[model samples]
Target chain A: MVAKRIIPCLDVDAGRVVKGIQFQHLKDAGDPVQQARRYRDEGADELVFLDITASVEKRKTLVEMVQKVARTLDIPFTVGGGIRTLDDARAILSSGADKISVNTAAVQRPEFIAELADMFGTQCVVLAIDAKRRLGRGNRRAETGERAANVESDIAREASPTGDPEVWFEVYTYGGRRPTGRDALAWAAEAERLGAGELLVTSIDRDGTETGYDVDLLAALAARVNLPIIASGGCGRPEHIYEAFVRGRADAALAASIFHFHRYPIPVVKRFLRQRGIEVRP
Target chain B: MMTRILILDYGVGNLFSLMSAIQREGAEPLIRQEIPPDPCFDGLILPGVGHFTPVSERLRRMRSAIDEVIERGTPILGVCLGMQVLFDRSEEGPGQGLGLIPGAVVRLPDSVKIPHMGWNRLHLVRSNPLLHGVPQGAWVYFVHSFYPQPEDESVVLARAEHGVSFPAVVGRDRIFGTQFHPEKSGEAGSLMLKNFLRLCRG
Candidate 1:
C-alpha cells in the first residue's frame, strides 16, 4: 500500500526560508538547505519550497538555491511560486527539483498546464490552487471571460456524479490576494483534464490559523477529481494532519508553521498518525 | 579502484539527483549524450523521468551501442522510464523498447490515482545482491503513471501495489531496473544505490 505523505513546506523568500501568516508578514525561519536537510532527517516524506518572492532579480537566486538543496537532500522536493513560463519551470526542474508547481499562471491561462504537461509530462506538473470559501450565496458572483466559458463547458462535459456542490470555494490568485470569482472545485476538475498530475489545494481562510485543515474544501475537491490532492494550510497538530487524511481525504498533508517552529517534529507526527492506523512512511 | 558509472542523458528530465546520489555512493558518475562504442565504465544508469515513447525512441537510436555495453557484462541499472525502456514496448506511446527484459509497459489501473506519486513499500519476492541489506517491506518514492509488466516472471525480484501489483524491481543477469526513483527514496533508496555500486564493484 502507498503510505500517506507528510510534507513540510518551506515558504522561501529571496533564497531564505520564511514563515508567513495568511501569506503576509513574512518572518525569517532559517537557511533553506539546512531546513531541508533537517526535515528529511526527521523523516519528512517530501518537501515543497515555494519561492514567495520569485522576482525577476531573484530568479537566479532561487535556481541556485534549488541546486544547493538538490545536492544536499536526497528526498524529492518541489519548487513553486512565480513559475509563469516554461523557462521558469525548466530552470528550477533542471536544477534538481523533482516537481514544478504553478498557481496564478495556470489559472490565468489554462493552456499553460497543457504545455507544461506536454513538455515535462503531467507527473511533474502540480497545480496549486489557493482557495477561500465564499462567505454567502450573495458573495458568489459569476465568473467572466474565457475562464467562465471553460468552466461551464467543463462542467457540462463531465458533470459530477454527486451532483452540484452544496457550498462553493472561490479561487484566489496572486498568492491569495486576488479573487478570480471562479469555483475552486470546477477549476480543479479542469486542471486534471488539462494534464495536471496533482492538485495542491490550500485554504486561505484557515491558513496559519492552526484551527485545522479545511476538510470541507478538501473533501469537495477530492470528490470532483481523481488526481492526488495535497491538503495545505491550517495544520497545527498531528491530529489535524490525521483529520486532513481521513475527513479531508487528502493523499498528503503539507504543513509549515508546526514543523518550522519545532512545535511537533515530523517523526512525532508520523508516530501519532501511525498509531491512529494511518500508513505513514517511517 | 573507484567505480566509474556512466549516466545516459537522452534529453529527459533532470539528472542531478541521480548523479549526486551516485556521487554520494562514492562512484564517479559520467553524464554523456551517447554511449561509447566500447564500455569504459563499470556501470551504466538510465535515469527516470520522461515520456515512455520519446525516451524509448532515443534509446532505440543507440541500440547497437547499448547492446555492446551489455555484451561486456557492464552492470546497467534503469530507473522509472529507464526501467520501462528495458521492456519491448509501452502503452504511453509508439516506440520500441530495448527489450533487454521481456515485457511491456502498461498504464496503471484507473481505480487509483493516475500518477502513483508518493512513498510506497516494496515487497521483496526473492533475495538478490541488488537489494542486499534492504528490508522486505521498505518504503520508496515513486512518480509515474505506467509500470512495466515483464513477460518473464522470474525477472521480477520485487513487487509494489498501485491499483495493481506491479514489478518494482526487475533483474536478469547483469541488467537491473527499478520502477521507483531510488535516488529520491531516502535511506532505503540510498542503501539500494550502495548495493548497486557494490554490484558494479564486481
Candidate 2:
C-alpha cells in the first residue's frame, strides 16, 4: 500500500515564505529553499509553494524561487497560484517544480486542464478547488454574504431526500473571494474527466482557522473523484491528519500554520500518524 | 575522475531536478534537445514524466545517436517514462519505443489505484550495481501508472508490488532503467545515482 502523504504548505509572497513562519529555533523560515530542505528531511511527502503575490513579474520571481528550491531538495515540489497560461506553467516546470496547481485559471478556462495534461502529462498538473460551505437558504456566496441571485440557477441545488433544503459546497475563485456558483463536487468530477491527475480540495471557511479539516467536504469530494485527493485548509492538529486519511479518505493532508509556527514538526506528526496505523512515509 | 552525463530533453516533463541530482553526485550534467553530433559524455540520462508516445517520437529522432552510444557501451539510465521508452512499445501510447531492450510497457493492474503516486518498498530481484550501496527493501518514490515488462526476465533487477508484481528496476549490461524517480527518492536514490556515476567513470 502506498503511504498516506503528509504535506506542509508554504505561502510565498514575492519569493519569501510568510504567514505565521516565525517560531522556536528555526529563525530563517523566510528562505524557501531552507524550509523546503527541512520539511523534506522532516518527512513531508511533498511541499506546495502557494505564490500569493499575484503580479506579472512575480511569476518570474516564483520561477526563480522554484529553481533555488529544486536545487536544494530531492523531494517532489509543487507551485500554485498566478499560473494563467501555458507559458506560465512552462516557465515554472522548466525551473524544476515537479507539479503546478491551478485554481482560478482552471475554473475560467476549464479546457486549460486537458491542455496542461496534454503538454505536461496528467501527473504534473494539479487542479485546486477552493470550496466554501453553503450554510443558508439565501443563494449567495459563502463568507461574503453578497447576493448571487442571477448565478444561483447556474449550479444545481438538490433538496435533501427528506425534503429539507440541502447544503452544498460551492466552488470559489480568486483566492476564494469570488464565487463561481459551481459545486466543488461537480467540478472535481469534470476535472478528473478533463485529465487532471490530482485534486487539492480546500475549504475556504476552514482555511487559516485550524478548527480541523472540513472532513465532511473532503469526504464528499473524495467519493466523487477518481484522482488522488489532497485535503487542504484548517489542519491544526495531528489528529486532523489522521481523520483526513481514515475518515475523510483523503490520500494526503496539507497544513501550513501549525508547522510553520513549530507547534508540530513534521517528524512528530508522522510518528503520531504511524502510532495510529495511518501508514505515513517515514 | 568525473563522469559527464548527457540529459536528453524532448520538450516533455521536468529534468532540472534530475540534472541537479547528478551534479550532487559529482558528475557533469548537460541538457540538449537532441544528442550532440559528437557526444563526449560518459553516460546518457533519459528523464521524462509525460505520455510515452511523444517521448517515443523524440527518441525516434535520436535513434542513431542512441544506438551509437549503446554500441560504444556508454552507460544509459532511464527514469520513469524515460524507462518506459526503452522498450519496444507501451499500452499507454500509440507510438513504439526505441527497442533498445526487448520488452513492452504495460499499465499496472486495475486492482491498484494509480498513478501509484507515493513511496513503495523495492524488492531486489537480483544483484546489480545499481543496488550496490542501497539496502534490501528500501523505500523509493514512484509516480507512474504503467511499468515495463521486459521480454527477458533476467534483465529485471528489482521488483516493487503495486497491483500486479511489476519490475521496479531493469538492467542488462551497461543499460538500465528505474520506474521510480531516483532524483526524488532521497538518500537511497542518491546512492543509486552515485553508483551509476561510478560505473560511468569506470
Q: Of the candidates shown, which would achieve the greatest lDDT relative to the real structure? A: 1
> Model 2 residue A227 lDDT?
76
Interface RMSD of every candidate? Answer: 1.0, 1.3
RMSD in Å for all candidates: 2.0, 3.6
Give lDDT tens digits, candidate 2, residues A75-180.
8888998889998898899889999999998988889999999999888989999988775545544434333442354344433211235667778888877887
lDDT (10s digit) by residue, model 2, range B1-202:
5679999888774788999899888899988888886757899999966788888988998899899998888899999999999999999979989898898999887666667887888889799987897887888888888989898999999998877789999998899999999999988889999989988886
- Candidate 2, residue A6: how far the Cα is off, in Å: 1.0
Docking class of 2: medium
Candidate 1, residue A183: how far the Cα is off, in Å: 1.0
lDDT score, candidate 1, position B61: 92
**Candidate 2 clashing pairs, residues 3+ apart or interchain:** none
